[model samples]
Target: MTETITFNDLGLSEGVLAGLRAVGYETPSPIQAATIPLLLEGRDVVGLAQTGTGKTAAFALPVLSNLDPYETKRPQALVLAPTRELAIQVCEAFEKYAAQLPNIRVLPIYGGSAYGPQLTALKRGVHIVVGTPGRIMDHLDKGTLDLSELRFLVLDEADEMLSMGFAEDIETILATTPEEKQVALFSATMPRQIKALTGQYLRNPKEVQVKSKTATAANITQRYLMVSYPQKLDALTRILEVENFEAMIVFARTKSETDTLAEKLRARGYAAAAINGDIAQNQREKTVNQLKDGSLDILVATDVAARGLDVERISHVVNYDLPTDVESYVHRIGRTGRAGRSGDAISFVTPRERWLLKAIEKHTRSTPAEMQLPSVDEVNATRLNRFDEGITNVLAEKEKISFFRDVVAHYVSENDVPELEVAAALAAMLHGEEPLLLEPEPVRPQRQSRDRDDRNSERGERSNRAGAARTNDRGDGQPMASYKIQVGKRHKVEPRMIVGALANEGGLRRADFGNISIRPDFSVVELPADLPQEVFDALAQTRISGKLIELAPDRGAPNRRTGERFQDRPARKPRRKD
Candidate 1:
């Protein structure tokens, strides 16, 4: 193995070196070690490295080192990221590395943030400006950003910018910059577009290429939980209760989901916060600082919001929603298992998305081990241990609790209750009405009878858990309506797809849908017999596999005229059991 290179040996300015020491950063990463010297030498370079490869420092340190702090605060260096979160992260890094340097100001400008502050900062002057391509273009069009004196220009995550359809904006902003300014472009992959842009801008650039690793870090314990759509939130809370995580980042699919999940976690007494594009820059900065200082335990965020984020305390990463692509999946989990520390990554996969899970495995060349949810006993044990620890802590603070102990003693005497009983009452008060232990889902046995009468009886008893039901006086006395959908084995329709479509489009809970029986060209599903016409209409318009769902009343029996035997029908399969 090659010898590790220290930051001191990288020839960084004394001010930058002091800042690095203050943050406990000693050695440089491979990309940093290779690119810093080239950047300091004012070479236009192209760096190929994935997220979390210390790419930010590879460029930021050298740019800051060469900055003239006493010069007129017109922006001297420009860094453009793909997303607002990444721009903010990169800007913060510049600030950290330039902390000991006087008269240096770094500003981050991004969309969804108020323009008043950005305008003020621009008017007051800043040495460095880091922003997303679109926002940077906005500034350039308005003539608010001055790049005439810019000595360094960095394009971080160039590939991601193109993926987000910002190529035009990027090119427009690049065209506005001075031709003499030194430029650096960093990206995980060099696609044709990025290559074309580099060819157009960079002049005989030095290429520092770091091969992408397909597999996840070996130090990360990767696991997946197969769950239904409805039970995912509950399942996440159960895991959080039992797993001893120092800090965690929960990745969701949308900004609304991040807000909803964060709110739910906060109601459960967790120090949780939501970080998304909608949040103001100052608020987002404060939330990140809180996470770093041990004040926040959980961060609920979307992919764009959490990009390029690095927190040493993040011991766990939970994929609340799977990404649309395999590369995104790897990037999402990459938030953890960083800084040479062992971390855990757990993903919740619904049955409909199992194919996605398999694809991720194939792409990453590693299979995630299946994990069982914590048993009720395990959860109870964790709760009891926490209660015991609380008691122990209170006992340890004897002097602080002496007055409270006397008051409790007086209450016990006045109420003529034993001290143990009083203590039990106090414990009960501390633990709220919500059950301390979760109830395991009940298991159902397979139906055995195949006779005509038995088959009819079984169909009658099927429960419609998703919608309103009317009792069938003759059978199990449950309300359920059976409907036929135009999708089956021929269409490659799976039970999970039907369930996912209904739950997603009809605004119904997972439990609303009951039994599903797939046939050659059509499938039958049981739902609350009294479902609103609006919901049923919505379901009819929902598309699966590019085919609109055609739902109608089930003809009690599939035209027996065809003489198809009841026993010849394929057995029903549950998508997943909660």
Candidate 2:
């Protein structure tokens, strides 16, 4: 077994040690254990670890051990992050670790905030500067940020920065910093570009990679619920009410969705908060702290905004919206099941997003078990149990209730009512107007049925056999309505792409679509006859090869005898397909 090391053994300065103790940190995490010694020696280092692996402290503690708070403040240390939220989070880590160290100033510079305050802070002199690449470049251009005397430079989530297309900006910033400044870089995945960056920027850096024991924590129980698009919000609410979770972080796709979901949860009496890119750094910090202290129970956040969020009490992670990619799904669920604690990861998979869900399963090498929404009666039972427990606690306080008991006695005597009736009236008064239970929702058809699998497999086989030109057959010997989409051979549109996009967009299985004939300008596809207006509308608005799927005008009826094919039409410039 590896030797256990604590914060005390890491050789942190007295001030940093005091701050770590204040934060209740005891032992060092795996990344911290391997990286602290290297960074403390002023050697350039590259750390490979995920978000919740305590990489921030792994870098921050050592940098603080070398930083001189009383020294000239021309930005002694610089940290660059991909997003504003991550930038603010790193800056806050510095502040917390430097709490006992006097005169140490750390400033977070990012876009979507006033430059006046950043300029003011810069003029006042700051020891460390943490910021996003784009905003940092803007400040560097204006000469508001000075990295001349910077002793340490750190890049948190370096791969993310490159994925966000900030490689050029990052290189420019690094070039401006003094070549002698100690550089430490951390990334979850080291792509070829990142390797090149390391070779160019880092000077024989000591590499530290602390691989997770498991792709997913063995303690986490993963499950998924399939619901229609319209009923997703209600499904989430029902799950939240019925599931016993101490704390949860609901992931949404956009900033506005996070706010909307949080508002709805709060209206339903949940202690919910929203964390996003638009929220101020101080407010975001306060919300996360509230979540940690048990003042808040649920936090709705986007992927970019929840980076470096490490809260021990997060018993559940609800994917209110499925992530766009498989890596994101893994990271979102990684927020929970941390520190060897058992946790739950629940995902809401809409019919249209089934492909994405399957992608997640394939990526993680584990399929989430199918879960059912709680019944109304079950939710009601939980509510009533909690209500009775609340009253029981009140009854235990008999001495404090003597005065109120007399008032109840007076009302009962004046109204000539039984004491039991008086107690019932009190219960009614306590219960608000809203019903204690919710209405039962219509049950949706299960997506994991054997019949659904057969349908998908059959569709895949038919598409494979049909090649590029095939007739529209609904598999039941019924004719399909042929439609033309604005992508074809020149655009590199394939039948699988068409099938996948249409099936996902229309919320239909692969078997629902028919043969696709690719032409020079456009392709002809056969879908179910008389498709629902809603499905048709969605298909029209959907893009196949970065071009909208448009309805082909009546080229007279499709020639059934010769099999449906697109007529000769003028081809446009070939557009690349993603």
lDDT of 1 by residue, 354-405 (tens): 6457657865778899999887778889988998899999999979989989
Kindly report which residue stretches of model 2 are placed more than 4 angstroms away from their true locations once superposed. Answer: 1-3, 214-220, 223-238, 242-432, 435-578
Error of 2 at 270 (Å): 9.0
Query: Clashing residue pairs, candidate 2?
Result: none
Q: What is the lDDT of residue 287 in candidate 1?
A: 98
Per-candidate TM equals: 0.50, 0.50
Write the residue-wise lDDT of candidate 2 on 154-212 in tens digits. 99989867765567678888888899989999998989989998999999999999865
Error of 2 at 500 (Å): 23
Show how many residue pairs clash in every candidate, following the order shown.
Answer: 5, 0
- Backbone clash tally (model 2): 0
